[model samples]
Target chain A: MAKQFKSLHPIKFYRDYLNQNVRPDGRLLSKFRPVIVNTGSIATADGSALVRIGKTTVICGIKAELAQPKAEKPKEGFLICNVDLPPLCSSKFRPGPPSDLAQVTTRFVADLILNSGCIHLRDLCILKEKLVWCLYADLICLDYDGCLIDACLLALLTALKTVKLPSVDYDVAIDKKVVNEDEKKSILIYNTPVSTTYAIFEDKIITDPTAEEEDLSSGLITIVVKEKELCSVHKPGGSPISEEKLYDCIQETIKRADLLNTLINTAISEQTH
Target chain B: MNVIDDNNLLMRKVNCKLDILSRPDGSVLLSQGDTVVIAGVYGPIEVKTQKMLINKASVETFYRPKSGTPGIGDRLYESIIQNICETSLVSALYPRSSIVVIIQEMQNYGGIISCAVNACCFALLNSGIDMKFLVASASCALDDKGVFHLDPDKLLSDKAKANFVFVFDNIAKRIIASHTSGSFNLAQYEEALELCKKACDAIFDFYKTKMKNEIANKV
Candidate 1:
């Protein structure tokens, strides 16, 4: 039937392209789409950035607010990363609550950020247990093609860089806290983490897979690399891949991290200037 | 060429595919100006006693974001879609039942809410559900310079002075639901309303072509 052909045609086309060591979009297996980043675009948020990877777009806004420190981590501040893949992003998600996909991605990015040691919690602490900066990094996907984690991480890092935290002083005279909006300080980021996603179609690995490619692929592997170190290698419940393939992905991710870091640095400098 | 003509963002074609999934009673994958959505409808099914309506079918809409679970902002979209569905459907015909619309987002450039509504409308029609009239939705945005645009892109939508999402019933061309954000004056609001209403004509035509193509494919 035509319906069967309709579904199978794309898979066959991808297979044909894979056989030639090329993609339908005319990119190599390790090539990534052109990435674009714009920082401090959202005036309302303390820090914000819009990041785009090919057709996929992610906007991240960081809202820093004062809050009581946790009883256990009294001396440490908190960073809550919430990644939103709204119905605006793609047809894969329904409109209502966060889907399982969103939660998984959020947890993955949160872990990546934490494991990368990009933002130190102790640096956010102010006045011991009395006051601390609660950084809320909200990453919203406006367009979804693929490589969402990569886009989200880039946006979060850029937005975090753009953040200007106001100086806070406790007024002993009136038992109040006076926030100095004029004196703003940016947070220190130790390392830059960039994620590279690959879709394993049979023996071939497709970099930055489109939504269609992802759906057709047998497995998915996401690698997060910071500097030259592998921060996280997330391959959850997919077709079996060889150890060599895994190592190759990591190497590709490392190379990609370097390229993306330059892009991020250039974007940050453009915004700062 | 002029700047307005070069920015053919609104002139892009819309693609719609129906009955893509087997599980749902009706399903549609709608793509407009890079904004893609998949809508599924399961209706006239049994409803839980606690959530059932005695006189009319209970309408439940579940909107799934691409990444995270639904939050407060999603609730607003759900409510808007719920209102539009409630007004369009003759729910009394299927008492003590439930009609669930599940919409999935793919790519969003702009005019998301309007696109979602349109997808839901098509899915409902595909489901062969009884309706008082067909519904079409369009969005209009007033940029910082006070220029009016139909189905504005992300950049314009982000910096626009005001934006409006309007749903219209096919019968009397009356407004079924209107959702607006940001700020605008009375004249601007009226201008946006008139512009959106005009934009709906093209949207309705797009729907007709989609429906015809879907029917032809089935045959």
Candidate 2:
């Protein structure tokens, strides 16, 4: 049966599918899995979202807590991003502490959030240096199929869109803070940065690979597009790729970003309604 | 002791997916309402010399919280899960090897311990590991008014006077583990146990349905 062939000679099975111009999962080389986004699902957190791309599921929750602003950046607040890839997601990850992949992904997501100017930290400042809203954005991988970075970024962005901070009245002289829970305001997001991951198998470049595909491929490239500009083009040292192929990946990401923007917007609107 | 009504005995909505992760021998993501936990099983593999056992497979558990390093509370959870897995697994079949069950707490609304235990059970089943019997877990909260709330949310749990988590095996529906916090009388504890025991039945049925679907898909 085909299942036996796939398990026994996986490379040959994949090559056979590639020869026919399709993937083992019946997706075209450039086709991506359907992305479904649901926002404000976790009631305990200030903002939360569940994003699913194919079978890879990620949930992001943002908890906004009051904290004193740093001495250097008194006008800005904090946005700490952490991505957890526990052993439950994949067997490659162990049970001890955060693995290298998890730490790298967290740094990448944090860098993206900062460089993209998606959120203005100053907007989070309530009483300048006295008090500010420190948003702790924690991304958890419930299912690890593939395209982990793409799913984590999407979940964080969507969850950030749903964040609502209560109105706080701070008396500077008395240093008293009274929070009005009734009047809540959402955060201001400037740019919507969307990332797309592709696997480079020999000379063929495939987008949104599953876990199996990622392993068989030689290299991986992730293109992050924000509006018409390129936010980041990350290639974590796989096989060498030509400039033209890189440019093509950027173009594909641009198109994908537009579609994702609409998807996020519709999901947020649906949550509000 | 205040008796819980039959209408208040229902658990939260349960959702689960088995074998969702690659690389792991078996994995499961289970959610009870908004409290989600994912568990993976890697077993009958190489064991560290210091921790190796001569007559049975050593069972180990790791509990990862949503964020930051695992604290003392998390370590307690790990041990609780470790004990449950050690007892249920037929480790004598694979001597000198080890079985590791890692549970990641995705979202914690309430009753997270129960969710993690159930998720671990499902992951072990998915790994096709030999076990004495399947286990199911359920939790309930007792408010100040002595009313029992099955599968209480964060708000309810925070306001509760006591909370209880109980695990039962499928073979005899007997208690495999019991964890409780807050102040409560002996009579109240007994009533809470009875309530959770009923809720465990629903969880057991859920596992059966999910396993049947998995087999059907494979066929």
Candidate 3:
């Protein structure tokens, strides 16, 4: 229930919040939750991380395996993201199967990483198309208080930072054409991206909303960035946002991006130690 | 000739929990060494007419085991989970309504049931009984190459000969629901049950730890 049962009454609460430029959480036009990031939580995974934004907690694990590449992208390695929300995270989520919500969100995250060039695709290449590294980044919600989009992004980044692939030897199987673990490959990484989310409740533009605020919101704006440029923006719902607000959101996200970039680096540094 | 030692492969797991979730009747996470499982119980709520049976409160259960999405989004599989839950639960006491239990396997490897059943028991206990007994556990197992292993990991799961899932009531010491795939021989079936017992006994230790943690935290 990301939307509060306030209407069918008047104007949408989220729209009104955006209009006033005051978020329900009492922040300015732009703000992010107090967040923390860590890594190596799942030692079994090649890379793993746990991220917390306020109360929203997400765990992301990355596993690398050898697989054949597609004919079209034979030179590039494989990347797959499965974003899961177990029912325990929220009362609204039902148990059983993947929801339409999960599918759309996963696409948004994947595109964000793909376009941002967070991973060095060439590093995953092995033996032309016969074998390559298949990276599976699995995101699980431990506690979804709100602003899950942002928390998920943070977790993804943290997991990517810690993920180290086994060293690859293309000549390991010169005759048999099989890659073996006689040696492991160095970790392959490119740049990293951070995602920020905003919820509109009336005129107030709330940043990193709590679950209650999320339900009250009419619409939300998610922004993913790398250094200075924007990687992606995902908006899902009936309510529409204006270009002016979107720009403000972007400008505001710039400031948050710097902070987020710093945090990610610090977390990654701690993880390596 | 070098072979991997079964003892060194890490065989067991445990969890410490308190009342974690706010809305559930009760909840717990059971980990069999990173094969993580979370189970929650909610209900005795008023049931929709179509869902209600004239006699007893229909039990609804949902399972999502990190493999891949199964047939439907929980609506279809809820019945299977509910049946597994009801077999050991005192559903008769909460008649004409519904008791919904949800199980999620987050980090799946193998022997998912061994952990799932344990989590389910902890959640049921937390849901505030209507219990006929103290606890119940369930496990899905397989045996290959005549080696009777308890709680196989993902690597072993791929090579297993049969898939056996059993639900048991700890109070009655009875096997409530035992299901076996066609691959195993009669002797294998007997051996798997014996292994299932070992798995169940291990999971019960997890159940106790969760209870103690919950009690200490008063969560």
Q: Is candidate 1 or candidate 2 better by TM-score?
A: 2
The Cα error of candidate 3 at residue B74, in Å, is 20
Candidate 2 residue B188 C-alpha distance from true site, Å = 71
- What is the per-residue lDDT of model 3 for residues A1-273, given as tens digits with 9 covering 90 to 100? 335544553345545555667654666555566887887899899888899998889999999888888999888887888889889888767798766456555756775676566776777887786778899999999887887778877888778777776655555456344445555554655666777788766545677778877766655666666666555544432133444565567677767888888888898888668
lDDT of 1 by residue, A111-198 (tens): 6777677889999988787889999999999999988888899999999988999999975457698899999999999888788898
Looking at model 2, the pairs that clash are none
Question: Candidate 1, residue A166: CA error in Å?
Answer: 0.7
TM agreement with the true structure for every prediction: 0.55, 0.56, 0.51
lDDT values, one for every candidate:
0.80, 0.85, 0.66
Q: Which stretches of candidate 1 lie over 4 Å from their true place?
A: A1-8, A172-174, B1-219
lDDT of 2 by residue, A158-243 (tens): 99999999999999999898999999999999989899999888788999999999988866777787887656655543444554
lDDT, model 2, position A225: 75
Q: For residues B114-219, what per-residue lDDT tens digits would candidate 2 score against the true structure?
A: 9999999999999999998888888898899999999888898888877777777887675566655554554676677778877888788888888999999999
DockQ of 2: 0.01
User: What is the per-residue lDDT of model 3 for residues B134-204, given as tens digits with 9 covering 90 to 100?
Assistant: 44444444544556555557776666555555555555344444433324333455555555655565556
Whose lDDT is higher: candidate 1's or candidate 2's? 2
Model 2 stretches astray by more than 4 angstroms: B1-219
Candidate 2: residue B26 lDDT (0-100): 94
Order of all candidates by lDDT, from best down to worst?
A: 2, 1, 3
Q: Tell the DockQ for candidate 1.
A: 0.01
DockQ, each predicted model: 0.01, 0.01, 0.01
